[model samples]
Target: MDTMRDRFAPVVSRLLDEDPRVAVVLAEIGKDGFAEAMRRHPERVINVGIREQLLVGAAAGLALTGLRPIVHTFASFLVERPFEQVKLDFGHQNTGAVLVSAAASFDWPAGGYTHMAPGDVALLDTLDGWTVHVPGHPDEAETLLRRAVAAGDDKVYVRLSVQANRQGRAVDGERFLTVREGRSGVVVAVGPVLDAVLAATEGLDLTVLYATTVRPFDTAGLRRAVQGADTDVVLVEPYLTGTSTAAVSEALAEVPHRVLGLGVGRRELRRYGTVEEHVAAHGLDARSLRERIGGFVGAGRASVRA
Candidate 1:
């Protein structure tokens, strides 16, 4: 299976050929993949080298001209580094651009903390009118990319990652897809972490909801999934832990519920290790997840602390 970032280049290239208003601005990340597209439409494919701030600023400028601009770079550089530019140039100015990011969470641990961005989704959550997509597979990434490209002039962030699931799930507009059904509780798995979530959740009598388009939060789907069942929700995200806990709370505000948000911890891992090591250390592997999730749901605890 190809990584989400691998599929992104071809998808954007096709978008460039199909739509004249579409443009991609990069910060020297994934430049080689877009070489053919660059040759075809040099003006539309802008590479701003390592200038992360300029990458966003230029994309916003292009948006002001009525062209739908797409910005690409690592998650840290794309969202965290030029966050002020993303806010001022795009949000404050009422401009729109598709910000695509690679290396989700800790894809390249050797690149150091500067390149890792497990908090990108949480950071974007602070902003308004930003649509976020975390596809579990490359095919889903392409589907979401096309949707974002034609999704009007609203801000969109398609998070591409080196990590991916073994298979792809269906893209159902902007709602979560129900992968399995049960009565005990609901486990919401976001992006590439779906496979592990499924593995950990097997035979647990818990409903599994796969999410690709997470910005809108799929409140309706979430509410529906928990109806007449235990209202305990375990959110397994590829990014920071507890990032979507608030959204879950809001969705089930009227109903009695307990939520356990599991993902990358806030504490920085000082040692540079492999992604597998990071996963184990963070307790995100199937064994750890099963232990944590099973304990949480099996304890019969009526409430989860915020």
Candidate 2:
């Protein structure tokens, strides 16, 4: 599978070379991937060392100067650590930027709690008018990034995870794409969690929906899909659990529905080794998802064994 960062590097290089108004701000990360690109367009690329706050601030400044800025860094540093900068510098000032984040959730669990950012999406939800894209595959990432860059002055958050699904590209719209069809219920898989969700629901009578563009969420699409189904929706996100609960609730307000939010558990497990271990610890593995989802739709246990 092609890595998201690897896919991003070339697109950014192309953007820099083609558009003089495009600038990239990095914070001691992605230097290896963007080494040549940076060297080629030294004036357009800026690295602010380890200072995430200054990194975002500089990006905001660049945006103010009529240049589109793509701010790249780990999810922890880009969204969590320098949240104030993101909220005030960009959100408050109304400056637009493509906030590209890598190492989503517990991708680098060995890096510990400080490096994990399960709350990044929830935090971004607090700010208004931010388009959040959680691409499930590298191809989807490329498509989303290109669209975000083309939609200049729109504050977009492109969340990239190390994990990927079984290669599926998203459609050219802000709507959920139906991957599998069934009458039991609807399973909405966000970003890289598609493969896991697919495995979990294998052989089950359920509908699976995929979304790369999460924010500006496809509420209309969701409502249309759930129109004649069981109205049992299970949202599987890669970030904080229940991140889209409110949106789902609003979308299906008039219909009688039962929704189960699944993602990295709310509690900090505080123990980690491999990515799979962290995912299991958070009850995000295929088995756990199957059981929990089964319970939600009345196919298994009375309650999920989390």
Candidate 3:
């Protein structure tokens, strides 16, 4: 499968070159690939070393100056390192800066606990005036990025992973694609696990909601989706049980909701392994997810179906 870099490089490069008002801040590590793309455009790029704080601050400043800035960085550095800067500079001031957080969750293996961001969803959800999106595939990523760039809203964070399946381009306006539709229950998923959800519910009657937008959630659409469902909804994410789960619960207050968060638990780092290994260790793999869904289905039948 093509990497997220391969999928987004062309589109991002075009946007940088075409939009004179756009500026890109590439992380020190992301510089090689992103910089090469920007070099093609020449005058639309900026570098901020390895200082995540400075990167965010600069992007916030650029936004204030009427320039659209896209800040690229590792998910951990983006969320933990420059958190205060993001909160005060962008969140407080409401700057129209787009944050592209790569290697979200455990996508970057052997990076260890220091670089692992298993709580980004929870952290960003706490802040107001921020739109958080975690695209499940490359096509969704492109669409979401384009929409964020065109959107007037400030403080947008896109949590990206390197595992997107680049099968084909997303259909127009397919950002919020409905993987399944059912009047009984809803299962919302983000990140690479979307494919897992699809596979798990191959013959189930439950609705599967592919929510690309994590924060500033589509409350209206979500509420409508779960309006008549008999059983409580289930939210799946690549993080701990907090943001995505809590948001759905709050949004569908009248209706019940359950969250099945999958990520590295808060603890010391262990042995080194690949991204898939880490995800599997923490029950984030497709098979584990399928079992969880099976349990939910069984319970739902007992409570609602029967």
Q: Kindly indicate the candidate among 1 and 2 with the higher TM-score.
A: 1
Each model's lDDT: 0.92, 0.89, 0.73
Which is the leading candidate under TM-score?
Answer: 1
Runs of candidate 1 exceeding 4 Å displacement: 301-306
- Sort every candidate by TM-score, greatest first: 1, 2, 3
lDDT of 3: 0.73
**What TM-score fits each model?**
0.97, 0.95, 0.89
On residues 231-261, what C-alpha lDDT tens digit does candidate 3 reach at each position?
5576767776545666676777876565454
Q: Judged by lDDT relative to the true structure, which candidate is superior, 1 or 2? A: 1
Our model 3 lands, by Cα RMSD against the true structure, at: 2.6
lDDT of 3 at 186: 78
Ranking by lDDT: 1, 2, 3
Worst lDDT 10-window in candidate 2: 297-306
Off by over 4 Å in 3: 34-43, 166-175, 256-264, 267-269, 303-306
